[model samples]
Target chain A: MKILVVDDEQDVQVLFEQRFRKEIKAGEMQFVFAFSGENALAYLNQHEHEAVLILSDINMPGMSGLDLLEKIKKTYVKPPPIVMMITAYGDAENFNMAKNLGADDFLTKPLDFTLLKEKLKTIN
Target chain B: MNFDFLLIVFVARYLRTALKNTQQNSVWDDRLKLAMYVAIALFVASVIFRDAETIMAWVGHLCLLGCIYILYKETFFKPAKSLIVAILPYAVVATIIQFLQLVLPSFYRGNHSMVDSLKGFAVLWGIGVWMVTIKQKKELDKTNEKVVQQEHDNRIITAMKDELEVQVAERTAELTRQKEALETALQELQSTQAQLIQSEKMASLGELTAGIAHEIQNPLNFVNNFSEVSNELIGEMNEELSKGDIAEAMMIADDIRQNLEKINHHGKRADAIVKGMLQHSRSSNSIKEPTDINKLADEYFRLAYHGLRARDKSFNATLKTDYDETIGNIIIIPQDIGRVILNLITNAFYVVDEKRKFGIEGYEPTVFVSTKKRIDKVLISVEDNGNGIPQSIVDKIFQPFFTTKPSGQGTGLGLSMSYDIVTQGHGGTIKVETAVGKGTTFIISLPI
Candidate 1:
């Protein structure tokens, strides 16, 4: 499965790469990284249906995680990719709002790779 | 003959009573009595000595006239024209009687005696009228004196009342002036209080912006540390694989796994710190939560430094920190405590930056932040190697609206607000220590 990870922090790319090193080396998963919501949207437009999963952070400089989720859910109707939101704010308000905006899943940061791996296996 | 003597006695008695009623001095009384006795004696002599009767009668009339003059003079101070006019008829009658007695002795003896008696009666009647007039005049004088006394008393009372009114007006004016002055002072105090509150809000907003720059470093640091460790581990594993040492390679891989876990742990800590910061930014509520003191102090130190750097690019200061790790987490209102820390660190940076601008040779600007756990309290101190606070103004450093910064640059509420947050808000203590030229340190102690 191809997964697109979106975060403002550049070091997040390296972190995700290292965390999924075994999966990538074993050819079980391919990862793509975008440092902003705008870049992630641009990548999706260039290669439609290329990314089966989109992981995004909610609090970014521009085009917040919810906004990107709305656009993706509205535009990509055929075989729509799964969208997950990650936020430092784990409050019920943000969770409910993201859920209402059609977010497939919600995760709180310091993303648990163990749990995330289990969830990814189920999606497969 | 008996009627003449009775008439003379009656006139004498009337004069005595009038004199007594006049209330004159003893001298006048004595003289009037002598005159009365002489008149009576002469009358009695005339009755007894018939040959010299006319001469005695004339002398008696003269003596009565003299008594009348004395009485009138004493009562009125000077004899009035009416009294003199009343005595004139008697004097004229007496003179006529004397002439007739001298000119016609036999005829005068027959008719002149009757005329003389009638003249004496007339004189007595005139004297009675004069006494009555004197008494009336005396009563009138008494009434005038009483009226004059009443007018004088009324004038004095009016004057006193006017003076009292003037005094009341002056007192009222004075009180009004005091009230207006106090009102103006109160207005000024209210405006200054408003400005101080506004500046505090501005300071918190600045801190929030600086927090973004300071918070990103934690996750980045974790990523760098683990990445370098994993790189070294991969090299070791590759060498063991080339040497066909599979067990050793497996051990190295396990170690790498532990390092990755550590990286994950640090990443979670960064996330938690970010969440706390976001919560602090959102809520103004003073809710007590378990907070890491060292991390809080270190976070604010960097936040203040970065905030200053953003404003003035040329500014530079050496930062140092010594944190006590045993004080893991203490219960406190993290937002309030975080604001206080940010304020102190910002002030430290400001002082050091000011000293740096002086460009003193070999002078290095530095700010040091430290935390320690005592037996029952926690101490956080911020120190700056800048020109120390003068002894004279050291006590006023934490006073509201007292500032050393120039106009428009500072509101002077920073330290005062910090003092309130630590002391009044949290039941803590804040104090300052300083030297003339060395440096200054502010210490805050919070109960565990």
Candidate 2:
């Protein structure tokens, strides 16, 4: 399973890498990263239908996760990647918006990696 | 042949003088003229009717009485009230002539005609009374004219007083109306000023809120990311332990420690930002103390600059400060004056930031803050080398909600409220000097 994580904070990449290092080394789960919505879209453009799951932070400097989710849901029809939205505030407004924009899951920080792993395993 | 004729002549001459003195074109003039003619006729009848001289004497007496009455009418009845001399003689002569006519039949018949002699005496008496009445009438009319003139003057004075009172009342009413209008306008202005200040506060609060939101996220992100990754690393470390990979578990522990340090640092950074915001938002200016104006100005200048830079990473400007060390401390409401100084510095920073956005090659955005000690006042000036205000809008800059900044970028009450604080609140003066395309200087003077 290949996963794409999108966030404005660069530290999120190191954190995600360290968490899934064992899986990445075993070649059972692959992880890709993009710092912003634009970079995420650019990555998607080059590797269509490559990522099985997308995890995105809702708030960013430009092009929020909800906007990216809407764009992804609208543009990609054949075998669309399952997207999970993450937020810092855990607010209902962002949650409902992401859900309306066809996000498959919702997560709020500080994240429960155990639950996230369970969800990932179930989806797979 | 007798002395009575001499008296008669004297009365005729005096009658002529009275007529000449009172030559008025009225009923009194006609009456007085007829009396003069009657006096002459009485003298002629005395001569023609020597045998019926007694009847002529009576007629002469009655004619003289008529003349005196006319004089009374002309004198207007208020003066000449003490004319007993004329009335007493007429009554005595009339009574004596009637009694002698009844008692003595031979008194009328004499060789010299006793009736003619008596007639001469009556005519003389009539002339004397007429002369006396005329003299009294002249004196009385003079006094009457004076009284009439005095009454006339009094009426004029009363009318003028009434007119002046009315004018004063009208003026008072007009002034009251003007005062009421001014008071209403002042109240309206106060309410509008309050609303404008609130709006300006809310606008800046929104910007500060957004800045805080952006600032807190970076640290919070580190905290969130590290905690979650640390949890995963613990799981990985357990797995390594289960696999007997003690070295790998130790390495993961070291990475987690480094993440914790970053988390702690970012958390503290967010805490500092919140503390600064809380300090700024507190609205209290009641207490006053001696404050170092130079130190206060410098602190706000840096605070405003750093706050802007934190919110906008691309914003940059050169700052120059010249603070007077001799002007140590002045009594002031530090918070209120601090707000004014902060507002000025923020405006300076905004102007410089705007100029920088234009990307002019030779433009160097600069802001200068200075404090100077004068004889009786401490002067603080904020000078900026940004895009100076245009000449037309310069005069209205201190007006409430008057702003040249783009809509949603500024609420425009910064300088207006600052002016109010320095002037209305502290009895100080605020002045602005600006040149188009050159620079602007805002000076605030606080009296020692």
Candidate 3:
């Protein structure tokens, strides 16, 4: 199954890949990383119905995960991908903002890869 | 040489002196005028009937008694002008008696025809003196009438001055009241002006955020899509590698998969941040509704974390939550209180992040949010383990425009606005407890 990871920080993407290196090597899962909300959209427009799950950070410079989640929920019709909001700030307001925008779940960083992997396994 | 002639002379002289004294002095006693007539009769009777020694002695004694009355009137009653009239008659009587006793003593030795004749003349003289004294009293009365008129005018003038002073005092008090009211109105106007400026700033921020969010989302969706497809192709290649097809896997392995995954993850994170920025920038207005305290706290925590993460990517903090299920839903304006929670959490994270940069070891940044119900109040506490606030600045944290954060990172209004939200908006209390090295805990109490 293909999973999309969205964060503005390049280091965050490296951490996620490193943490899930075993799963990717075993061919059990595949990971896609988008550096920004704009990059994520650009990748999505070219290849549709590819990402089965989206793990996104709530805060970024230009386009945020809640906005992206809103667009994904609004535009997609059938069997939408599960969108989980991830933030370093475990603030209740941001969590509510993401949930209200139709996020499937929420998490905080330094990415709890164990829980994230388990959560992703359920979606898969 | 006769007793009656002597009496007549004394009565004339006494009448003349009494009239002259009444005219000279502004205040005179009316009793002095009546006593003068009694003195003339006493003197004539004492001289003409000299053999009636007892009657003559009684007349002399009455004259002496009048003199004593004059002395008493002069001494004790001197301050009052009214007492002068009371003593004037006594003075006239005493003067006549003095002349009769000293000048006509032989006439008082026995009764004689000449003395009898003299007594009739004395009566005539007494009538003449009474007429003259009456004329003198009229003249004095005219002068007294003028003095009374002057005194009346003085009293009226004094009353007018007193009334004017009272009016001035009242007007001054009214002016002071008006000035105080004007000052209060001026303060209210200044506060309104500040609020208008804040609203204008928020409006511009909202518009800018919405535009930025819209522009970023379009390109972000594109990157996310293509990255997902690339990952799928990489996955298919990985499947082939597991099935013993290494050549195809090698062609697709290093470049496409790595870059595409980077685009997907970070792209969505950027999108979420822009969205949060847009939502947070919205102007605050009263939106009262029933809200779950626990859920509200969780949302603000995430927003606070996102805000801190956006500033510095390396900041890491461990967060813990202990929500009391008993503290159920409470009515509130979510955004207002949400901002409060967001500010506290952001401050907590900043404290930890700053501490870490200074090579502080043996301590991991920790934030604990706990909720509890006590009687009729719900308490929400945000506790942070970091370099605690300094003693000098701790008391000033909730004051408007006060901050310990670096200039660009803090507007200095975060804690103040939070205080307003908790105390004024929600009718609750917000307090902070901190130790120099231990950490800080912000406790918010809301009435259920």
Candidate 4:
């Protein structure tokens, strides 16, 4: 399984890489990193159907996660990739909005990598 | 005739005594004395010239007319129509008796002595009547004087009352005008006070949001993730040890150690951010203490940068600092000075950010903060490479409520408050240097 992680903070890349080191070594999962939603979309456009799951942070400088999700859901409908939104605010308004925008899942920071791994396992 | 002469002498003596007792220093007194002398002369002439009785009588009549003229000229008794009418009949009868005595002796020779005595008696009666009329005129003069004095006092009282009423009206109008002015000023003050409170609340909210979202949250996320990763690494290490893979366990142990250090570093970062926020929120006690000026400036610079970045994620600026090694801890109110430093740095960043948004060609936004140790003072400066303030408004920049920013965007009190904190609270001087289209620098000089 291939996954794309999008966040504004560069440190999230290191954290994700370290947390999934076992799976990466076992060759069961592969991860790609993008610093912003716009970069993630650019990556997706260059390599279509390469990633099975997209984990993105909602709050960003440009091209927020919800916009990317809406574009992805609208353009890639035949083999829709699962998109999970992560946010510091876990308010009901954001949750409902994400749900209405066809987000596959919602996660609140500080994220639980164990639960995320379990969910990835179920998807696999 | 002898008895009449004696009566005239007696009346003249009585009038002289009355004039002396009254002490009336008037022309009327002199005239009365002259009349008394004339009456005495007439009486002596009448005795000396018994054969010239007609000449004596004529002289007596002339003296009486002179006395009447003096009385009229004195003006002490203004003769009214009623008093003149009362004396008219007496005056006519006296004149008729004098004429009859002079002319009837030739017509009726019978009882010539009786007629002469009758003439003397008539003369005495007329003199007595004239004396009584003078007394009555004096009494009337006294009553007239009292009436005139009362009228004068009444006119003065009336004039005084009119003046007092005018003054009262003027005072009431002045008081009313002052009351209206005070009420208007009070209303304006109340409205301004309410606006100030509202702006204060908004400013604090912005600070709180920036501090919580960027300063505390970022490091806290790192600390949590690093610790969780370390926990996982520890579990993996135990598993490898149980399998008797000593080399793998050592590798995992090393990773955990590095993770622990990262965790410690991130934890301290979060702790420092919280402490800085607490310091800002705490009310200033205005107590002077020894503080490292360089460290203080550096800390506030980072805080203001992060705060601005938290609000506007696209904002970017290069920060530079120069600190004098010789300048150590200086005694100052750290909190107040910190606020002043923060305010200046924030303003510097704001101006540069505004210029950056203008998309000037080859423009790079930069902020420089420097501290220098002078002979007997310390100087702190914040400089920004942004469009400089116009010369027209530069002088008014430190005045309260003076701002170039649009209304509601800025409370306009930030620079003024900073000026107060630097100059009044810390006993320092704040000055600004700027050049058009180049930049602005705010310098603060503090006595050692």
Number of the top TM-score candidate: 4
Interface-residue RMSD per candidate?
11.3, 8.4, 12.3, 5.6
Task: Point out the higher-scoring one by lDDT: 2 or 4.
Answer: 4
Per-prediction TM-score, please? 0.49, 0.52, 0.44, 0.58
Candidate 3 lDDT tens digits, B274-318: 654544565654677787878767756655664455444455566
State the C-alpha lDDT per candidate: 0.75, 0.74, 0.67, 0.76
Native-interface RMSD of candidate 3: 12.3
Model 2 Cα lDDT, one tens digit per residue, B63-149: 545544554565542233333344435435654655566576456344235555655675566568657767777778788898999
Model 4 regions more than 4 Å off: A1-124, B1-150, B162-166, B169-198, B204-208, B243-261, B278-300, B323-335
What TM-score does candidate 2 get on C-alpha atoms?
A: 0.52
What does candidate 3's lDDT look like per residue over A1-124, in tens digits?
A: 8888888656555555545666887888888999777688787777778888888876654466776788888877577888888854446777777777888898875455568778877877
Taking the tens digit of each residue's C-alpha lDDT, what string does model 4 give over A23-79?
A: 988999999999877799999999999999999886654466777788989988879
lDDT of 3 at B413: 72
Best-fitting candidate, measured by lDDT? Answer: 4
What is residue B315's positional error in candidate 3, in angstroms? Answer: 5.7
Against the native complex, each candidate's DockQ, computed on alpha carbons, is 0.02, 0.14, 0.04, 0.22
Sorting all predicted structures by lDDT, with the top scorer first, yields: 4, 1, 2, 3
What lDDT tens digits, residue by residue, belong to model 1 across residues B382-404? Answer: 99988989999998988987899
lDDT of 4 at B307: 71
Residue by residue across A34-84, what tens digits does model 2's lDDT show? 988879999999999999999998665345677789999998878988999
Give the higher-TM-score candidate: 2 or 3. 2
